[model samples]
Target: MLAFVLLMAVVGIATPQQFWPSLSFVGNSLADIAPFLLLSIAIAAGVKATGADQLIGAAFRANAGKAVMVAALVGALSPFCSCGVVPLIAALLAAGVPLGPVMAFWLASPVIDPEMMLVTAGVLGVEFTVAKTLSAIVIGAVGGYATVAIQKAGGFSDPLRGIEVSTCGTSAITKPAKPHWKFWDDKDRMKDFVGEFRRTGWFLLKWLSIAFLLEGLMTNNLPMDNIGQTLAGLGLWSIPAAAFVGVPAYLNGYAAIPLADTLMQMGLSKGAALSFMVGGGITCIPAMVAVKAMTRLPVFLTYVAIALTGSVAVGLLYALWGGVIG
Candidate 1:
């Protein structure tokens, strides 16, 4: 997408001056999130270094059904970005963690965090922020449970194809033995932490740099007035349309808040705004690319399907109660 946008500029479809906003947008977005991103990455490194993955693996191994709910809650609280979370997901899966709860955490972690929640509240209002936070957990649980049910029904038996599974650090088969709770006390473990941090941090910087660049282009070029007008008061179709357009049209979660607020003031339906946020936040380009690397075709497609379906369903439900919420 970023390449395509740049191509348009070179071909005269867009002028050089058009990118001025894009450059500023990219700069500001990075400036706003840089500190938080570093903090989240550091926290994730601590989780990986201290053997928390083993503890999480134990829970998922114990009862998959119960773990799905727990995973959703944990995902909401964690501030990790999609790329940062990918390494952790790989570690968990290779360690024999159940797929159901892992999916929950993956789907939810990118949508909202403590900093994001406060930002949402400040920009979009308390009610919208609260609704969005709740939506994250609901979307996660729904995706997780749906994956479980589908697996039980003989779907997704072998989700990975061509990707080799191996324990990241020590060996191929991760034993059920307890991890040294103070693993970071060892020199080898400190090395492991530094390696993990570099790996995940570099992945995040590379992908998100591109994603935000594309976002900047879209923000400056896309004619959002048409979207706001199209979604205004359209009864049933508005919800699905919002979710559908959100997949490709959204910038990112933080950028979307003010945009959604503007659209709402322009007569966009409340449900449409909500649906767009959930849809875009979960399946954003960077997140999808991260998931694609870790999952097979079937699992990747399933993730997309669950996100779209859940977003549309939630949009409809909220629309039905528009008399009150609106």
Candidate 2:
């Protein structure tokens, strides 16, 4: 299904004149994202091999609120890209971590990291950096709580798509089994490790291939300068507009800081700028692809909705009183 979908997307987007370059974009992107992909695969495989899910289950189930808060806070500070964060998410899900905290980490991890924050401070301002960091944490917390609330009413019963969750569910969290740190001693564990490594690696590469291909095509076709200017002129609508526009138009987080600065210099509203950064961080095509690859349809849709709405709310609030916080 993934292959057929990717093939269809390629055929639809890559015209004859653009086919080779689009392929090149996918190739280059794969190479560029290789470190994160390899690391993610290794982490997932290691967790499976060593039965570390036991530890993970214990950590998350202790106090749901604490787990969500810690996840949101760590996600903001840790420097993981959309692709780099997947293994942790998968591991958490497999360990039966509640969707709330998993979603918190998923939304926040790609938004702001220490390196990105410092670069943002340098490029934009210390004020902008601080505000964005707060935004990441706040958005994460809100999304997490919302998921928790909805799921309590029976919304996200099965949150996973590819990776299987714990059959023990809440029960596993209550009584986590002891893990075998030296998994190599067991032949079954060794085979599971190898199998997981290969499975996760291939899955990531394929999804990312399609994402990069779409990114390349979009990059070539979209009038980004015009889009930036449009964001500048939308006045009261600018915040929500930024939220929507940011999904497809956002550059990489590192690359985006300078661009955000440039857009602000060109009269982009502060609210719109903040909205674009936060919204884009959550819903950029690659991030969305990473998310979609892991979660079921209902969970994925809710994630997008919550992210965009939270970004818009944050942008509007910042516009009112960012100076006090920043």
Candidate 3:
């Protein structure tokens, strides 16, 4: 899609000298941000392979309620983008972590993460970043708590009751011998880290490539101007509408940032645009299919419900703020 966009811009500009500036504008935009996308993927893979996710899962298993709150808090602090959060969520779920907390983590991670917050500040300004961060925390905490309450009330059940736990310990031990190991035991941290990097790196790479391709295609081909015009005055409907539009499109969170900027510039409400970008990032066909394969229908639907509700809340809040401010 990046290539196609570049090509089209070149063609468009060559035909009309006035459009030449558009080519440089778009090219510079793409170039300026591509590295962040790559870095997000690498960090995601590293976090997954380093047992960070398992550690989180174990913490959750120890105390479900506290774990849920802690998960929300940690999500706020972590730098992982929405795309980065996906694998971590899957890992937690596979590790028998409860659905409520996982939902919380999913909802909170993208909106509250440090990297995203910084980027949000740059793209939308500090006020918007603070609003998004606060909203994400509130939504994640409420969603997590609500999910737990609902489940305890017998509204949902474990979906992975029959699955076997695959041990990564043995594989961690025999992978390779590395230098700088203490002649004594328990000093091979570097080797262990390297092994983990390889495993998670591969997983993240596969999905990142797919996400980039989808994003590129959307950026190049989707009629952003038309979408902006159509969604202009819908107000509250914008949130759910954005959610609906985002699902099939399957853009990663970071990829949607530029698109969100375009929509906001075109008079789409900030709340609605944010909601759409968040929904597009976390809830998609690919993500749902992945979750379904690992768990059952009830659990999968629970996640979808949490994400949709959280995103809607984000949109509505944005709308409320916009109304007051405007």
Candidate 4:
């Protein structure tokens, strides 16, 4: 809020005539996505307040050959954003949860949460929404199972940095308590709900504002349109190129949707757009920082490799399939 206000003031003073248009662009963009935004916030708050989110842990069951597959699905379905999933990842790894399921969750959790999925569908259409969701699942599964294979080959001998890997056994990260559906019945839970609502709402509002503002600027006169066309003109290389760019883009899941829309309008191919969104979501700065902090350099590097490769592969396959056309 303070940041947005400062932005408004700076724009207002620097170019008084441009002030209304900038603010109005952001305002109208917000209005257009208001329903999905509200639903996203409400559901996230509700899950947090009631502790329903903990259910995702069940996907990482011990001795289950299908754990990786289930984990990938659970990760895609869970509402936890990339940054939000980090603490749980840390907890799961420290609790001796195998690297495979954790890797699956880490890669998939951020790509498309409930909020991201809804907004993506709203902004980019059903095809994009489906592509992004499948991207998450496929990446998570491939990364997860691949890690398991490597671990079996004596790789990732020491995955964590400072975190102590406890002996494999039952723990809280593996088994969560039942959710309190009627959270209001408990004052503490009610407080949790309110706090989560405010925090999530504010966090999303700030990012969305920045995203829409950037979109407005690009739509107005940003020279990036030519850049987009050039990238699109690159043919198949455009997919990997977008995936690489997404690694450093650092845009938030929700924030990236409008940007993707704008870029598509500027001539980005559908596959390249998906690659950008998927790759960016996985390697967003916050999540990368968290991964670096919690894991050793090899693990961090491996994580990046998996994300980039998976994103490119997803883009390539989507392109080959004609991106929802065939």
Candidate 5:
């Protein structure tokens, strides 16, 4: 990625005047989103440091249906990225938490969060952000309950058949000790919080910077209307096409936002945009790899099916009722 950025920089240097617009676009995007992005990161750090995530996981050690609902809601609200959520999923499954709720959180964790929402609203619109948030929760709940039903029907003889507790690495990552939020009261936690803040802030900065840069380059160089026409003219096919394409070719959620906005500007329908986000964000290779590593083949395949089906279903609903809802 760094190499690609450097290569683009060389290109920009060669056409210095033409690249100025791209730079300006990047600047504007940064300025617009900086405050919301910082606020979100602070909130996420506080949540993580306070052991809220572990508390949520602990709550799932009860009745299946209620567990699934709680897990789904946590997944929707928490600011966990796929990479961050993987260890938690491992811990939950290894500690005898049911597969249904774990799968629910896994499917929804990467799709949206407060930070992602603010960024989306800044780059896209409030409507897109709101719909995407609702879709994330709905997808998680549906996937969880569906897994429960499947489990009850003898679909999974032993959901954790091949999974080992040792494979979970350590509980520390998944279940951090309850923290003292006051900065001075716990020096160790404060250090941890600061480190997390740095890491997360850097992660967001790098990816979102890349996204804005790409957006700028595309906006300045591409004939977006021509490309948009190709995608837009597909009509109903566009929704599934977006989902299918997104599954295999997804970048991270942060990067996808600017790209989605660019596509919308070029004439992509709201449904197609939503489908692309759901498919790509939920089924991205990293998230899938994490799910596969933690579950048996049958469970892994079921997750894939759920993600695709839910994405398409949500897309169809939005396409049908988006105008009335708006």
Candidate 6:
């Protein structure tokens, strides 16, 4: 998409008004989202470096079902994005954790986390954030339970049956090892966190830049009236339509929310916009590829089904409630 946008600019196919807004919009969007993105990536790196992943994995090995439920809750509280959470989920699953709860954590982590909620509040207002968070919790719980039920009904067992738990022994011995003053000290930790921040901060900036350029081209070059007219009569179907449109695109909650807000103001239904955002988070190609890499085909399909169903349901529900509220 970024490449296509750039090509149009070079060929003089794009007007000056369109080209300039595209550039400025990209810059502005990146600037707006920089803080949340940095914070989220830093927290993820810090938690991993501090052995939280190992500790969490040990807990999962102790009681698979209960551990997954707890993981879902913890995922909701953590400030990681969909991409960031993938590594943690992969680490847990690789450590002999059950697939059911791992699926739940992956589904819920992006939409329910604190950073996403904060971004939602900033972009769509507090009401939207509350609604999104509540919806994510419900979806995550349902996904978790459904995964367990499917596993039981199918008499399925894990394929990675013999993998040893990575974190099992990390927390078993409670002796606190003194950190080397070179790397584990407070100053070093801060430097490490800042380094992580710069890395993820750059990543966020790159994507937001691309998104803004796309948004600008769409806004300035596309025929607004025609586009609006085509989408106007969608009504309830708009939510699902938006889901289809968003699923293939890769945008986290932070980047998607502001675009969603803009769409809503342009006569797009709130439910549809929200569905697009959620679906984008859950069903992007990168997310699916990551899941497939770690799990079998059945598990991967189940995960995709849960995300699609949950996104569509939430979108429709939001539309119904929003109608009443208005």
Error of 2 at 113 (Å): 1.3
Instruction: Please report the candidate that would top TM-score against the real structure.
Output: 2
Model 4: which ten-residue window has the lowest total lDDT? 56-65
Tens digit per residue, CA lDDT, model 5, 1-326: 48436846875878877566766765787676566566656655554555454444444544678888788889988876765675456546644567788888888888898888999999988988888888888898999999888888888766764444322223333553554557436676576567656766665555555555654554466554565567788988888877876665566689889888888887788898898899778887656755665567898888888888888888888888876776
Residue-level lDDT of model 6, residues 1-326, one tens digit each, is 46646654763463654555566656675566456555556555565445455555555655667756776777677776565565455446644466667777888777757766777787788877777776667677788878888777874465332223454454434433333333346676667556655654554444444544554554445453454445546877878877766664435566577667767777888787777777767776446655665566777777788887788899889888988988
Q: Lowest summed lDDT over 10 consecutive residues: which window, candidate 6?
A: 175-184
Give lDDT tens digits, candidate 2, residues 1-326: 47736665666574677777777777887787688778877887888788887667667767777888888998999867877887768878887788899889888888899888888888888877888999999989888988988988988887788677764545534665678888889999999888988887777777777787777777678787888888788886988998888887786798778777888887887888999999988988888997888888899999999899999999999888854656
TM per candidate: 0.80, 0.92, 0.66, 0.67, 0.65, 0.65
Candidate 2 versus the native: TM-score? 0.92
- In order, the Cα lDDT scores of the candidates are 0.75, 0.82, 0.62, 0.76, 0.71, 0.64
Worst 10 residues of 3 by lDDT: 175-184
Badly placed stretches (over 4 Å) of model 4 are 1-61, 168-226, 323-326
lDDT of 4: 0.76
Point out where model 6 deviates above 4 Å: 1-55, 159-229
lDDT of 1 at 172: 24
Residue 172 error for model 3, in Å?
Answer: 25
The better-scoring model by TM-score among 4 and 5 is 4
TM-score of 3: 0.66
Two-way TM-score contest, 1 vs 6, winner: 1
User: Each model's number of backbone clashes?
Assistant: 0, 0, 0, 0, 0, 0
State the TM-score for model 1.
0.80
Clashing pairs in 2: none
Model 1 pairs whose backbones collide: none
The digit string of per-residue lDDT tens for model 3 on 1-326 reads: 45545655665665454345444544454355345445654443444445454454555665787877877877767776555555556556655577778777766776556776777778878877776677667667877898888888987765553343333333333332223323224345445545544654455444444444334444555676787777777767877888767665545555566777888887887888777766665575445544554567877777778777777777787778878989
Model 4, residue pairs in steric clash = none
| Tens digits of per-residue lDDT for model 4, 68-136 | 787789899887777556545655664466788888888988899877778888889987899899999
